[model samples]
Every structure is written in structure tokens, then in C-alpha cells.
Target: MTKLSLKSKVDFIFIIIIGIFAILVYSTRNQSQLARDSRMIVHHTSSINTVLEKILSSTIDLETGSRGYTITGNENYLEVYNQGHKNLEIWLDSLRAMNELNRGQVLKLDTLERLIESKKQISALTIKTRKESGMDAAAAITKAGRGKEIMDSIRKSVAAYQNQSVKLLSANLNQSEVHVKSRNWNFTLFAICTFAILFFAYLQIRKNTERLILEKIIQTNLMTELTVQNQQLNDFANITIHDLRSPAGNITSLVATMEQDSTLEEYKVIFSMLRKVAQNLNESLNQLIEVLHLKKNKIIQQELLVFQDCYSRTIESLQGEILKSNALIKADFSQINSIMYSKIYLESIFQNLISNALKYRDPNRRPEITIHTEITKQTILLHVSDNGLGIDMSKNGSKLFGMKQIFHNHPEAKGIGLFIVKTQIENMKGRISVQS
Candidate 1:
């Protein structure tokens, strides 16, 4: 039956679209990871090359400074020699920190290090000989050609390390290119499939437009009937509450008089129980009357209310409770300061929300409440948030605004505040939602 329906066909197409979207997302993520790895390889290779070049430059500087000082016997040449040594040590340490090198690459690096150390020792020996021994001694050591051989060896080792790094980089880049080409082809195919499905779905949606128009007419008629029925239900509730009010009041009066006249302790206890029951019944009837009045009125008064004024009035009314709980209240009405709404309902909303925040605050921390206003294209939104014993949404979320539904085990929780707030907002064609 579902297969035969046009809407079902459209839904199936949409489901396919979602599947394709998921595949595309996965492909994109994989491509991103591969690209990231390639970048890391390139960066690592660049760092190694930079360190190698620095080591070669420092080796040359050490050789130059030693030779220059041996010939001229100048003290300034020692500064360059000392600086070259410091730079070489730093650059080598940096290269060694790069542990991603393979065994072959690490071996090449070790050979380079050995040659650099030999060159450094030779340069230091020449400098010390020139300083302590005569110029002849230092010149004799330089002329022996061992320092030249060590420098040549260092250069060759550097070239080998550089060649190995370039080879590895080229291999990695080639592999990445292959993967990229495959992924690009697959993505192109998926894109073509997505376009074809969307085009087909668009045609199917055009065909369903007339059916939607007819359904809208039927829905309008059904809404009319629902409105009439709702009015009738409201009337019935009004009559029921009116009939029950007198009986509830009578029960309360009788219980009170009986309790006062009772002599026996057991009878007094029984009368007290009856009194409590009667009082609860009376309170329930009163709350019901208030709700029925809202339904009957249909159109309550609306006025332009300034948010700051309303907020201040509510705060003033609850000044005692706020001080007692050490609540820090904040308000921001900068977006839209005024709105056309019922004054009583707006004030009641502020009062109930703030009272709950202060009442159910976390005892370990001082209470902090934030009230703010936001404006969308067509609606003004009021938000109230607090640091308190939050509702257990998993257990009590559905029944949060239901009549007489209490979540926290507080003595003063009548459970009617949220119910009344929700009713008021909905009565004015507004809405309310909560997050824990």
C-alpha cells in the first residue's frame, strides 16, 4: 500500500537522498584526513631540510671563523665561532626531536651527525692551537687536510640526507595523488546520482501540489469543527466548576466547625484530616475556576508593556524572597524593549519563573538568574534561565507543565505555576518551551 502512494514514493526518494548525503559526508571526511596527513609529511620534510641546511651553514661558519682567526689572530673571529657552535647544537636538537624518520632516514641522519661532530672538533682544535700554541701549529693542523676531508664528508652526508628526504616526500605525494584521483571520481559519480534523484523528486513534488491543496480545504473544515467542540467543552467545564464550588465550600465550613467542637483526641485528629481534605478540594475548585474564566473570556486585555518596567515590578514584589536566597538577578532587554501583550499574564510569567528560580536554587552555590529578550522576524521572545536544581528531563520532561505535577521535593511546590504559565501563553497564541 505504501509503495502505491505518491507521498511514499517521495519519502523513499528523500530517504535515498539522505543515504547519498551520508556517503558524501563520509567521503569528504576521509579526503580531509588524507590531505591532513599529506600536509604533515610535507611539513616534516621541510623542517628536516631546514635543520640540515642550518647545520651545513654553521659548519661553514665554524670553518671560516677558525681560518680567519688563525690567519689574522683577531679576537672578533671567536664570536662567530662561538655563535656557530650554539646554532649547530640547537639545530641538531631540533632535527633529533623529529622522530617520524624511518630507519634508513635515521641512519643517514646519524652519519650526518658524526661528520658534523668531527668537523666541529677539528675547528675547535685549530682555534685553540692558534690561541695557545703558535700560528705555525694551527697552520700545520689545517694543512694536514684532515679538516678538509671531514668538511667534504659532512657535505656528502648532508646531500645524502636531503636526497632521501626528497625521495620519501615524492613517494608520499604520489600516493596521496592516487587516492585523491580515486576519491574525486567517486564523488563525481555521487554528485551525478544526487542531481538525478533530486530532479525526479522535484517532478514528483509538482504532481502532489494539487493533492496538498485539496487536503488543505479538508483540514480547514476539520479545524472549524474542532473549534466548535472546544467551545462546547469549555462551557461544560464552566458549568461543572460552578456546580462543585458550593459543595466544596460547604465541606470546608462544616469540617472547621466540627474540628472546633470536638473533645476526644482521636475525633479531633479525624476532623483535622477532613478539614485538610476539604481545603484541598476548595483550592482545586478555585484553580479550576480561574482556568475556566480564561477560556470563557476569549479576549483578555492587551497593552504595550515595557520589559524593564515589568521586570522591575516583579523584582520589587519578590524582594524579600530574593534577598533571603541571596539571588543575583540580571536582565537584558536591549533587543526589543516593548511588546503588545497582556500585562497580568506578562507579570505573572516573570513572577512565577523568578520565584521558582529562587525557591529551587542550588544550596551549595548562590542563585543566579538571567532574564533576556530576543526578537525574531515575527516574534518577541522572553527567556528566563537560572542556576538551580534543574528538572530531570529524562524522567519528568513530558509532564513538566501538567496539572499538579511536581518534580522537586520542595514543601512550597504547588505544581500549578508552570501549568498556569503555559495556559496563559497558549491562550494568547504564544508558546513556551524549557531546557534543563
Candidate 2:
């Protein structure tokens, strides 16, 4: 398991907790708003009820006062009548103001207002007749069917207003309950979603940790394989160089001994062939030895190497062959001064490239080689180019620097020169590429 730092773990947990708290706060606020709406609805309903009750009581008081006046002709009945009329007027005004605040109550309040007006008109007519005519006449007017009909109509209107108020209150209550329930469920779902997201983030962190470990293990295994391969290559080169050195030494000694005598023509020819073979073998062995040395170490045995000096030295090594092939060699090292490099490796790379150019020259054209160097901020680039027989792109382009790979079917081609060149450059923490 990969252990997270305390701060990071705390931050992750803090974010999850904060997220859940935010959701809960939002849900609580919504529920609070719904509760406020429900309370307001209840208050409005109570207010409407109070107004209706006042109106009903005022109508009842007017009927009683009119009856009292018809029977006794007392001034107290008129006073009671006036008080009830004032109360009714106040209640109707209050109801109208409430209806303005609550649009849904407007129609019911209008109907109630009309009923109160009709009741007021009938009570006024009764009062007027009672004051002018005698008690019997006023009593007769009070018992008339018109006044009773108006009272009945007022009762019917109040009943309708009361029924409508009850229905509206029930609807508001039901809607408020539904809103509360939905808020509760939404809070629960939000918490569940936050937990799932946190869990998924945890799983992803664990997976990434495991992936990093696996990649590290893979890189270690690759490094081990490369080490083993390098060791095997070095051992092979060492053995080959050791075996060839003995015969090369013997042939050089034999050639000196034969030159001491006036040799016969056949003997001279044999000695010359042996000397040429020995020289080629020595050159091949030296190349193998240089490759082996480079594989065993990283930093080269650096020595001051002047570009012009190294160029001349390489030219001298290939002088006889260059002359035989009539090859043209050009050099431009103006941008470079004396630099440090391993002498043997540098000589080998230069010798192989120049000699290859000569060996692979086109039969119909003269061999031309150009050697130059360019210096950049981070590295130096050395380019060795030739206008000889260009490489065959279709056949051997990809395997140009592969071990024991040859592009041309030349008798002297050993196929290891470019491979050694690439290895040496890599060992020195540089890179090499060829384009032909």
C-alpha cells in the first residue's frame, strides 16, 4: 500500500466533509423556506376565519337589534345597531385589505362584501319604519319575508367563503408536506453520491500507486538485461583479440626475417600475401579491442585531440589505399579547437568511415569524402559524408548499425565497424546517426 502524507489525507477528508456539509446546508435552507411558506399560509387562513366570524356576529347583532326595536321602541336598540354597523364596516374593510395581499381570497371577499351590503340595506329599512310607524307596524316589517330572505342569503355566502378557505388551507398543507419529504430524500441522495465519489477517488489513487511500482520493476529488469549483454560482448571481443595477436606477431617477425635474405620470387609473393593478411587481421583485432574497452567503462581515456592532427593521422593510415582508389578527401574544422576524447575510439571511428568510403566507391565515379565539425551549446556534431556508392535504402537501411550486419557484399567487409562506432558513442554519453 502507498501511504499518503498526513496533510494530503487530511485535505482529502476535509474536502469530502465540507462537500457533505454544503449539501446538508442547502437542503436545510430549502426545508426552512417551505416551513416559512406553510406558516404564512396558516396565518392567512386564521386571519380570514377571524374576519368571517366578525361578519357573521355583526349580522346576528343587527337582526337582534332590529327585532328589539320592533318590540320595545327603545333608544338602546338603535345604539346597539349603530355599534354593530360600525364593526361590520371595519371587518369588511379589513377583509378587503387582506384580499389585496392574497389574490386567491379576492373572489370570496367580494361575495361576502355584497352579502353584508344587502344585510345593511334590509336592517336600515327596518330601523326607518320602526322609528316612524308604531311598534306593531315596525314588528310587521321585521317579520316580512324579504328581511328573512336577505339573512338566509348572507348565511349562504358566509358558508361558501368558509368552505373555500378550508379547501385552500388543505391544499397548502399537503404541498408543504410533499416539499418537506422531497427535501429529505434529496439530502439522502446527495450524501450517497458524495460518498461514492470519494470512494472512487481513493481507488484511483491506489491504482496509480501500484502502476508506478510496476513500472519501476520493469525498468530494473531491463537494466539488468542490458548489463548482461554488455558483459558477453566485452568477453567475446577480448578472446578474439587475444587469439589474433599471436599470429599477427608471428607474421610480422616472419616478414622481417624474409626481407633479411634475397628471397626467390615465389617466396617474396608468399611473404607479401602473408604480410597483407597479417595487417588486415591486426586492424580487425585492434577494432575489436577498442570496442571491448569502451564497453567496460563509461568515461573515455581523454587526451587533447586536435581536429586537424586527427584528420591527418586518419588520412595517413588510409594513404596507400586512398592512392590506389584515387579518392578525394576534404576537411573543414574551422569551428573546432583541440578537444578531449579517447584516441583509440576516435581513430577507429574515423578510420572505419574513411576506409569504408574508399572500399565502396562507385566504379563509374571518383570517391569524394568530406569531414567537418559543428559546435552547439550542449554538444559537438561531427559529420563524415561521402559521394561514393550510397547505401542501398531498400535492403539494409534499418540494420546499418546492428551487430555483425553488412550492407554490401564486399570481400573485406566484416560488418562490425558501424556497430562499434555506435556503441563507443553511446558509452561516451553521446549519440550517432547516419543518413546516406
Candidate 3:
């Protein structure tokens, strides 16, 4: 059995209690109604029995009077006969009234009415015989037993009708009891199913809530770890840049002093080589500093910038290096007139691309490079290409824009230039693509 959560368990218990209470209430109400019905049935049956008894008593009285007149041959016995006849009429009316209340008793009433009429006819004949002849003749007529035989037949019919009424009453009572029992069972089963559904729903809600809480906790921990790692990387970059600055400065100063003393030719060549190495190192240091600045924060507070003016300034900065390499330079700015960007960032991008073209020139070929812009509905497209030592697409394609990944064996290649370019583009919510 899987363990249920606190809320789920509470809901389960609550639902079960509610179900039990509902069943008790419903069963009590149903049983009360069933009892009321049973009482009504019993009341009707008792009334029918009372009517039946009255009719039977009247029949017995008529029979007795008929026999009495035959035996006594008196007018007083006729009085008894008349009284029984009147009572029979009254009982029949009462039977009819009772049957209106309980229609099942109608058959018994009909049989009783027929029997009473036959008895009345037989009593009238007895009276006639007593008045015409003597008591002996009436007695002989009674003893002949035709009236008794008719009475016997009437009694049998009444008994059959009573038996049928009794059977019908018993069947109705049994059916009513069974129906009440079946309703009780169905109500109990429905309550159980409803409680089960509520309990399961509560369990699912609690499980999902718990899972969400755990996921949030894990995400918080991961974010905290990443923040600490970023801080450590920033600290290391600062320390390394501070340590390298002094040595690079001392080397540049010593090479400058040696180049100024030009008495020895071989020493001058050695000093020039040392000066070039120092210049390269200084460039590498400057690149590192720029990258660190970008990593700290690329967004700068700046005034509106004109792209044409910025491009002209960047080209002027690289004019000497471009002239030395004899590189062909083409510029196009007709489509995009200007954009809002930091002038330093734009200058850095232009200087890096132009310097790389000059530094990575194909030894056997003339250098050529192109820079241009195209505007669309949503964005401005910038293209920078070179026919110098173009990138070897197969060997360095994937890592071309990665940080600190050098492609050609150029002395001035620091590999951070294109990486910075890509980062700057993305920081402005722009995109960059390279092709060879």
C-alpha cells in the first residue's frame, strides 16, 4: 500500500464519515416511509376483516332465523327474520364502503351480497310455509335441507374470496419489504463509490504539489552554485591581468632603449625582433582587458552614434596597417545610414576584423577585404569578408568563433577577436554568421 499524504488522508476520512452519515440519514428516512406504508396496509386489511366479520355474522343470523321459524311456527320468529334481513342490508352497505377504501376486498363483498340474497329468499319461504301449514310441515321442509345446502354453497364461495384476499395481501407485503431492502443496499454502494472518487482526487493534488515544491528547491540550489562559479572566474581574470602588466611594460621599455643605440647591426635586428614580440604581448594584454570589460557588463551609457562616421574613424585607425599589407578595402553604407551603438564597441569590432585580415594574409597572394551593410524590414545586416588567408572551412569551422581557439599559425593571432565580436552582437540582441 502506498502511503497517502496528510491532506489526502484527511479527505479520505472525511468522505468516509460523510458517507456513513448520509447512509444513516437515508436509511432512517426510507425505513420511516416503509413503516408508514406497512401501517396503512395493515389498517386497510383490518377494516376489510371487520367488514367481512359483520357480513358473516349477518349471514349466520339469517340462517338461525330461518331455522327458528321452521321449528317454532311463530310470527315472533318472522320478526327475527326481518331483523336479520335488515342487518344483512346494513352489513352489505358497510362492505361496499370498506371496499372503496381497499379495492382488493371487492370480490369478497360481491360474494357476500349474493349469499345474503339467497338466504333472504330461503327465509321468506320458511315464513310462508309456517303461516300456511303447521310447525311440523315447516320443520319437515327445513329437514329436507335444501336451504342448508344453499347456505353451505354460499359459505364456500365467501371462504374462497377471503382466501384470495389474504393471499394478495401477503404477496404485497413481501414485495414491499424486498424493495426496501434493495434500496438500502444500493444507497450504501453509491456512497462508497463517491467517497472513493473524492479520496483519489485529493491524493493526486497533494502529490503534484509536493513534486513542484521539490523542483523549485533543486532549481534554487543550481542557480546559487552558478553564481559562485562566475564570481571565482572574475577574481582569477583580474589577478592574472594585474600580474602580466608590469613584465610586458618592462620588456617594451628595454627593447626601445636597445633600438635607440644603433652602433651594432646584429644587435639592432635582435632588438627589433624583441620589440615586435613586446608589441604582440601588449596587444594580447589589451584584448584580454577588453574581453574582461565585456564580461563584466557589455551595456554602456552612450549618445546616439552615426554608423558612417564611426566606420570612417575605425578605417582611419587601421590605415597604416592596411597600407603596409597592400590590402584592397571596399565600403558600402547606402542601405543603413546609422544605428545607436557605443562608439568604442563599434571601433573595437572594426579594428579587430581589419587587423585580423592584415595579420592572416596569404603569403603568395594579394589581400582583399570588403565591409558593407544591408537593411531589411526588421533588422540591419552587416557583412565583413576577406580574400586574404580565408578560414579553412573543413578544419576550423566549428571552433572559429570560440574563445581562445586559434586557427592559423599567425604570430598576432590572439583568437579572442571573433569571440568578442559574436558576444557583442548577441548582447545587442543581434546575430552573426561566418562563411568561407
Candidate 4:
């Protein structure tokens, strides 16, 4: 994966981490708020119970005052009755306000109100009868027990209100317990998930480190093996140059000697063929030695050499071929005048390109080769193009620069030229491309 994509994925994970934190914070807040609401419900329910008790107490006080006034005909007792009646109204009003949301409690409070009003009226009537119609009338009303009946009704209604309030308080307490349990569970789950994520991250990091270390070890061993193989290759190349080229040189000498005395007309073609084969074999060996020499010499010998000068030398080497083909050559190195390169390799590269272009020229058309250069901050680019019998790249793309991989139907197409050029360029830490 790319660094940017990995970074993005890491950022996404952090976002998820942050999101989890937010959810925890939000849930914690909700849990706390729920707890507070539960406490408030308890407090309000108690307040309501207190108010109902006060109402009942005030009603009893009213009843006691009425009884005293009726029995002893005391004006001071009527003042107590008046005080209790005022307190009863105030407490009932508070209870009604507190229980407004509870429809059943409101109805019970309404009934309590009516019962209190009726008891008050009956006590007042009994007291007024004691004042106006004397003890006989008041005592008769008491004997009938009408005021006691009204007081009993008031007490029953108050009890009903108290029972309902108790039920609500009990329900609120149960809900508070449920909220407490839920919040605990939520915290527990959050802890578990966080631990799991951290554990997984640790495992992945350790695994990746181990894998990377293993890969580095393998790469080190491969590089060491490659170095040994490359040294052996150079040694074999040196051996071939000494042992094989000496015999080729001897063959060339024999051919030259035989040619000097040749008189048989029919055997002339055979001698010429043998001479050509000896030269071709010697040339291939020399090219191989050059390639292996480059591979063995790991140290770069660089110089600031003019590209135009190199191309001129290459043309000079191919002077005979150019004349034979009547080829036209063009050079434009103005864009990039010079390069830091090895003189021998650079010259060989140009010579091979020019020679191949000429060698592969179409019989129906005159050969034209163009050489140019471009300069960038990083690289010096050289381009060589030709109007010749071009190879079909699509058909032989993979093998284009492979050894002994010929493409064209040319008598002298060895196919090792492009491979050598590619090796030389790459040895210099440069890359090459083919368009056709």
C-alpha cells in the first residue's frame, strides 16, 4: 500500500477511536442525567407525600377545633379552625401542582379537595348551630354522627392519595435501579472493546515487524549469492577470452594463409565462407569479453565528454557501412551538449545503434538515422531513431533485448547488439526504451 493510503486508514482508525470516546462520553452523560432524574423523582414524590400528610393533619385539626367549639362553645377554638382551614387549602394547592402530570393522582387530589370542603362545611354548620340554636341542636347533630362521617370520608380519600403516591415512588425506585445497571453494563462493554482493539493492534505490529525482518534476511542472502555468481561469471569471461579467442585468432591466421595460395575456382566459395565464420566467431567472443569486463568493473570511470564528439567517432567507425548503404545520418545535441559517461561504453553504444540501423535498412527505401539529446534535472536522455526495416514490437516485446533473440530476416542479425546496449546503460544506472 502507498504511504498516503496507509496514513488515511490510520486516520480513519483514529476517527473511529475518537468516535468511540464521544459515544462513551455521551452515554456517560445520559446515565448521569438519568440517575439525577431518578433522584429528583424520589425527592418530588416525598415532597408530595409530605404535602398530603400536611393536608390530612390540617383537616384533623379543623375537625378537632369544630368539636371543641361545639362542645365548649369556645371562640378561641374557632380561630384554630380558621387557621387549619387556611393551611389545608395551601397544602392541597401545592399537592395539585406537584401531581399535575399524573392524571390518576390529580383525580384523587380533586376528590380529597371535595371531601375536605364537605367536612369543613359540616363542621362549620354544626358550630353555627351550637351558637344559634343552643347546645341541644349541636348535640343532636353530633349524636347523629354526620360530622364524623364527613371526616371519615376525608381520611379515606387522603389514604387513597397516599397509596397512589407510594406506588409511584416504588416505580421510580425500580427505574433508578434499572438505569444504574444499564450504565454499569455500558461501561463494562466499552472497556472490553477498547482492550480488544489495543490487543489486536499490538499483535499486528509485532507480526509485521517479524515479517519485515524475515524479508530483510532473505534479501541479504540473495544479494550475497548474486555477488558470488557475478564474480564467477567475470572469471569465466576472462577464461573464455584467453582460451577461445586464441584458437579463433589461429583460425583466422590459417584462413589468411590459405587464401594467399588459393587457385581452385570451385573451392574459393568454401574458403571465403570459412574465413567469414572465423571472423564472426571471433567478433562474438570479443563482444562477450567487452560485456563481462563492464560487469566486472563495478567502479565507474566517468568523464565529461561531448555527446556530439562520441557520435562523430561512432560514425567514423561505421564509415564503410554508411558508404555501402548510402545512408544519411543526422545529429542534434544542442539541447544537451555533454554527459558524464565512460568513453568506451558510450562510443560502443552509439556504434552499435548506428550499425544496426544501417544493417537493417529496407531495400526499397534509403536509410535515414536521427540522433538527438534532451536534458532534465535528473537525467540526460539520448534518442536514436531510424527509417529502416523495423521489428514489430508487439510480436517480440519481451525478447527484444534478450541474447540470441533475432527479429528481422537479415543475414547478419545477431540480436546481441541491443542486449549489450541495454546492459551498458543499466550498468551506468541508466535505463533504455525501444519504440519499434
lDDT of 3: 0.61
lDDT tens digits by residue: candidate 3, 1-436 = 9998877776776677677768767876776687568646644654454455455545655765666566555556566567767877886787687577656567656766776677778778777877888767776766776776777666666557656655655655565555455554544455455445545654665433454345456645655655554443433333333323333333334333432223445443433443343333444445444444554463354457777776665554454455456778888888886777755566556766776787788878888888888888868887888877678879888998887789888765666777766755765678888788
Please, what are the lDDT tens digits per residue for candidate 2 over residues 167-232? 776677666656655665655565456556556655655533454345456645655665565455
Which is superior by lDDT, 1 or 4?
Answer: 1
Model 3 TM: 0.38
Tens digits of per-residue lDDT for model 4 on 1-436?
Answer: 5454645656765677678879978997998798789768866875675676567657756865776677677788788789889989899889989988988888887787888888888888888899999877987887786776777687677767767776776677677666655665665566556555555545644434454345446645655665565444434333332223222333333333432234444233333343343333334445444544555475657789999877865554454466567899999999989988976668768867887898789999889999999988868999999998887888998888876678888876666677767877887989999897
Worst 10 contiguous positions by lDDT, candidate 4: 240-249
How many pairs collide in each candidate, listed in order?
0, 0, 0, 0
Q: What lDDT score belongs to each candidate, Candidate 1 first?
A: 0.69, 0.66, 0.61, 0.68
lDDT of 1 by residue, 95-173 (tens): 8778434777767778878888888888889988998997889988988989878977887787788778767666666
Q: Kindly indicate the candidate among 2 and 3 with the higher lDDT.
A: 2
Best by lDDT: 1
Q: Please list the Cα RMSD from the true structure of every candidate, rounded to 1 decimal place.
A: 33.8, 52.2, 55.6, 51.8
Clash-forming residue pairs, model 1: none
In model 4, the number of clashes is 0
